[model samples]
Target: MRSGRLSFSFTMLMIGIAFLYVPMLVLIGYSFNASPLVSVWGGFSVKWYGSLLHNRQLLDAALLSLEIALLSSTGAVILGLLAATALVRFRQFRGRLLLTGMINAPLVMPEIITGITQLLLFVSMAQMFGWPHRGLTTIVISHVVFCGAYAAVTIQSRLITVDRSLEEAARDLGSTPLRAFWDVTLPMIMPALASSWLLSFTLSLDDLVISSFVSGPSASTLPMVIYSKVKLGVTPEINALATLIIVAVGACVVFAGYTMRRAERQRDQEMQAAYRQPAG
Candidate 1:
């Protein structure tokens, strides 16, 4: 009975995997199709990808998206790190709960609401200050607002796992609090920072609703371009683009996993070597 149950569970897991991945597999396969209709498969051809190179508008939009992603991700990481540090280190402050709630409120709020609110604020600011009428800057600001919340949550979680004793020990050894943080806490949480940055980058790149609301005529992101094209008609070019993005993200994830594994292996080897060394 136990063996039968195990076999059943394995089969269910396989089915779940197939259900989740089959659509992506089909999309990737169709990227090579010669037919314009993505649903219908034609003989393999690289024309779509080749055309993508020549499409100046799409290329420009893609570049804009990359820029927004980079800038917003950087901003998010900086703000999030500061917020996370405050939340973790200044736990006794009054209004801590309120601050935490405000920091996390974006995560649960509807995207439409967030977009509308940002748009209103941008318009008001523009009218009042006559600054940043509309463009990449506005979009980056909107993205940073949302993405920072996610980064803060990730970094705060990592902080919770760290031992405070390490920092205390460093302080006792004549290191300033800031210097101790740099030497001890920073190294331990570096992985979380890297992860948070990547996560924010991906979120900013993939954003559509908030970006669309805040963006002006000059700044069109990749998602906005893709969305506009979808409204007109679905094209094989979109499939090709989607496939490329999926492959890029997948490669990054794999590379990160490999690097982490290598670090672990090196650490294990060092520990084993130390154990094997003569008693001191």
Candidate 2:
């Protein structure tokens, strides 16, 4: 009976993997198709990939998306670090509950509601001050609002496992709280910070609904452009664009894994060497 259960579990796992990956595989294959029809699947060709260079609108949108992602990710990281620090280090502060709720509201709230609320807020601000418009600035700010929530979650999770005594020790040695954090806590949470930054960047890059609501026509993001194209019907060029993105993202993931593994091995070797050394 156990063996049968194991086999069933294995079959289910395989099915799950296929369900997730088969569509991606099909999309990648179609990206190279000579024909424009998605279902027809003509012989392999790279024409669509070549055509991407001349598609200036798509390129502009992609560039704008990158800029927004970069700015929002940095802003998210900074805001997230502060929020995470506050939540983890100062647990008994006034209005902590309210602050925590505001920070995490994006995680639980529906995207449509968040987007509409942000749109309304921007409209109100514009009317009140006439200082800003719905464009890259608004998009970046909206992206940071949600992305910082995710970043805070990631950084806070890492901070939870951190040894507080280390920071205390730094403080005991005449370091100020801010200096202790910089000297002790920051280094330990660098990995989490990096992960949060990447997550923020990815979220901002892939966002559609929020960008669509907040973005001006002059600052349309890549996802908005791709979404419109999909509505018309998926073409080989879009498939090709997706394939390139997949490849780039996959490469970055692989590189990050390799870098992390190498760092881990180096740390392990240092620990072993320290263990072998004579004590004072």
TM-score (all chains, Cα) for each model: 0.90, 0.92
Error of 1 at 141 (Å): 1.3
Top candidate (lDDT):
2
Best model per TM-score: 2
The segments of candidate 1 whose C-alpha lies over 4 angstroms from its true place after superposition are 1-12, 264-280
Query: What would the TM-score be for candidate 2 when compared with the true structure?
Result: 0.92
Give the per-residue lDDT of model 2 (tens digit) for 3-80: 999999999999999999899889999999999887786898999999999999899999999999999999999999
Output the lDDT of residue 237, model 1: 91
lDDT of 1 by residue, 29-131 (tens): 9889998876677799999999999989899999999999999999999988888999999968888898799779999889889998988998999999997
